[model samples]
Target chain A: MDNLKIEGTKQTPEIDFNSSTGILSISGRSIPENTFEFFNPVLLWLDEFSSIAPEKVIAKINLEYFNTSSSKYILEILKRLRIILKDGKDILVEWYYEEDDEEMMETGEDYEDVSGLPFEIISIDDE
Target chain B: MAKQSIYQSEIENLEESKNFLKKSDYSKLELQMEFKKLVENYEELIDQVKIITKISDRLQKKLNKTNIALEDSNIKLADLNDQLNETIDQLTEAKIGRKAATIVMIVAIALFIVSEAFIEPIIDNMFPNNFLVGLGLKLVVAILIKPGEDFTNKYMLKKARKEQLRESQLSHNNKP
Candidate 1:
């Protein structure tokens, strides 16, 4: 499968999913004008990746902020990851938040509970 | 057109299930499977709602706190700007006062020189017995000194304020 790469903007996050490495990363703000349009390709890519499932998959998510619709799409992405986990493949989700952002840390915990995926809630220094 | 939603696919799936129950002719086993699927979907939907609501509210609180901090910073910045402008005005007034004093002193010295060289001689030739006229002329110059300095100070301050206003407007216009 071809790797997926999307550039980050002021209103959107960067997406870099490498099929060869089984490493998926999303970072920056996500407040897209069209949530479905922004996420549909990502969902389709995950579905494709699931068929040719790799030995280990890692999803790194680091977001400063996201709107409500973007939040729903994030949940959808985690659900797809859960499917991959159920396929007997090793899966890990690394959720990064700034050190001072207590709310973001709690958000990662909430996602961990909701997704039921193995998550490493990591704190990063503020830039 | 209907507004696009992130939940559109989920909503469609639920509608499909509803329609299947209303119209599909299914065996008992098929019915049981469909019911299970429906329950699972419903459970997932509920979980999504619960988590999304919790996250949205938390982020909203964070946003509100940030806005309050931004407002406080803006107020402090405005206060500092006012203080700076007042200091500049005070400095400008002191500078203009000094300039006005210097100009008045120079004019007083020039008048003294002219009176001694030209006016005193003419006065002595016309009124040989009266020495009070020369002293009175010098006294008039001294009396006008305060009002002359006051006028110069007012003029220079007005000009300085006008220049400051013009520079500010130019800077505002030039800002990208």
Candidate 2:
């Protein structure tokens, strides 16, 4: 599968999914005009990647902020990863938040609870 | 073409139902099927509402937290700005004070020169060597120095304030 790379914008996150390395990263804000349109292709890609996924899949998610609709799509993305896990694939979610952002840390915990995925909630200094 | 919107399918479903009701006969079986579809749609709608509401409320909390942080930062920024303005004012006063003193000193020197070159000769003609009179004239000039410096300081300060206001206005207008 071709690598999926999307540049970040003021209102959207960056996506860098390398099939070879089995490392998918999303960073920056996610408040797109159309939540479904923005995430549909990502869901399709995950669906395709599931069948031929590498030995280990690491999803690095470092979002500064995201709207409600984007939050739903985030859930959808995690649910897809959950499916991959059910198929005996090794998958992990690395959720990063700023050191001072308690809400973001709690949000990562919430996603971990809802998605039933192994998550590493990491904190880093704010830019 | 842009991707189909998330709501498109839901909207089309509603439209189809509306058209069916308008054109089709009121048969029992058809009505039952239509009602079933509507009920299913309603259930899905309710599920979506639940999810959206939960997420919206959570996000609202996050927004409130962010707003509080922003307001705190703004307050700190305003405090810093006030301190900066005070420092600028102090520096401006010091600079204007020096300028005013320099101007007053130059004027005093010119007055002294004029008195010595031209006015002292006339005084000598009238009084035949009145040392006290010359001393008094020089003293009068010396006395005026303080007031001259005061006037210069006030004028320069007013001009500086006007320039500051103009620059502020220009910046405000230029802001995007």
Candidate 3:
């Protein structure tokens, strides 16, 4: 299947899901006008990718800001990743946040606990 | 039309379970299995609600902080803009004052020249013995210099302010 690449905008995050390297990345702000419309395809893509996933799959998430609805979608994404893990694939979620963004770090921890998935809460330098 | 929710499927599942429970089922195993499914769904739903609420609250706090910072920055910017406008006004006033002085000085010089070449001769012809009239004309010209400069300065300042208003309006109109 062709790789999924959605460009980032002022209101939405970028999504780059590579089937070859199995390095799925989501970055930038996500406050789309319609959260379901924006994330439905992402969830569908994850469902399709779960079957043909590589032995090792890494999901890199670096979001600057997201609204309440986007938070639910983020959970859904993690749940999908958990399924891939259940399929005997080595899955890792690298959640990146700014050094000073304590809220984002705590949010990542919450996801980690809720999803019961291996997560690396990485702190990155602020631009 | 109503907007679609992310929890539509979960809600549909719950509705189905409710409909199934309303029926008097024959098999105990089937009811037990359905109860188990209901419990699982409820647990998952609770977990989702818990996590989502926590995250939403944290993010809202972050957003509040950002908004406070932005407001502070805007206040600072407004102060800076006021200072800049005051400086520009002072500069424009000084510039117009200088131009007005120059114009008044030139008019004074031209009046002096005219008095010396034409007005002085005419006065002399009219009153050959009176030197006071010529001196009085020069005095009047000197007296008018201050008022002339004041008038010029006021006119230039008014024009400058009108131009500034026009430019500001043009910029405001041009903004997308």
Candidate 4:
């Protein structure tokens, strides 16, 4: 499948999906006008990727912030990753947040608890 | 969207009921049944709405933050570009200033040579007794030097101060 790459914008996140290397990265801020439209493709891509995932799938998510709808979509993403993990593929979710964001840290924790998947909450340096 | 509106209206009605519920006169069983049913439904809806709304709003907040962040990044990028342009302008100004100073110095030297070598002999021929005109002209140029340098220095300092204040104001406004 062709890699899915969307440029980051004021209202959306950057998506870098490499089919050859098998390292998927979602960075920048993600606050889209229509949550369903922005995330549906991501969901579809994950479904395709899971079918023929690499031996190891590292999904790096370095988001500055997101909306509630995006949060639900994030949960969906984690749930998909969990499925890939259950398929006996080595899966790791690298959740990057600003060091000073207490709410974001708590949010990551909440997702970790809910998803029951291995998550690495990495603190990023302020720009 | 209609359902969301309904939820808001329901919450509003509940609030209104809470206000008048104490004053209304009703039989014990009537009050118990009405209150219990309302409370039970309210509690359940609140729980469901709580989860839905929480997820909804958190995602909204995330999107809002991303927008603000993108704007901030753009502002920072603009500021850096302005600073770079200013630096380039300063460098160009300094280069032009150095060249102007050199040209002025050369002109002064040429004027000195003309006065001493060519004009002194002519002045001597014109006025045998008084040649103070040459001295007076030289003195006027000499007197203008310090004030001219001071004016240039003060003008540059004021311009720099204005730029600093502008940047500071921009930073203050951006803080939030």
Instruction: Give each candidate's fraction of reference contacts reproduced.
Output: 0.53, 0.23, 0.70, 0.20
Worst 10 residues of 2 chain A by lDDT: A71-80
DockQ rank, highest first?
Answer: 3, 1, 2, 4
- Predict model 4's lDDT versus the native: 0.75
Q: What DockQ does candidate 2 have relative to the true complex?
A: 0.27
Clashing pairs in 2: none
Give the TM-score (0 to 1) of chain B in model 3. 0.90
Model 1 misses residue A42 by how many Å?
2.0
TM-score of 1: 0.92
Every candidate's DockQ is: 0.51, 0.27, 0.58, 0.11
lDDT of each: 0.92, 0.86, 0.93, 0.75
Q: Give per-residue CA lDDT, model 1, range B1-176, as digits (tens).
A: 11246777678878878888897488998888889988988888899999999999999988998899999999999999999999999999999999999999999999999999999999999989999998899999999999999999999999999999999999999999
Instruction: Name the candidate, 2 or 3, with the larger TM-score value.
Output: 3
Between candidates 2 and 3, which one is better according to DockQ?
3
Per-model TM against the reference: 0.92, 0.79, 0.94, 0.47
Give interface RMSD for all predictions.
Answer: 4.9, 4.3, 4.7, 7.6
Which scores greater on lDDT, model 1 or model 2?
1
Cα displacement (angstroms), candidate 1, residue A46, comes to 2.0
Predicted candidate 1 versus true structure: per-residue lDDT over A31-97, tens digit per residue: 9998888888888898889878789999999999998888898998998889889999999999999
Residue A103 of candidate 4: its Cα lDDT? 57
> In model 4, how many backbone clashes occur?
12
**Best-fitting candidate, scored by TM-score:** 3
lDDT of 3 by residue, A1-127 (tens): 7799999999999999998799999999999999999998888888888889999999999999999999989988998889899999999999999999999999999999999999999999988
Worst 10-residue stretch by lDDT in candidate 3 chain B? B1-10
After aligning candidate 1 to the native by TM-score, how far in Å is the CA of B87 from where it should be? 1.5
| Candidate 2 lDDT over residue span B1-176, tens digit each | 11265555567778888988797468888889988998898776665556656656776788898899999999999999999999999999999999999999999999999999999999988888678998899999999999999999999999998999999999999999
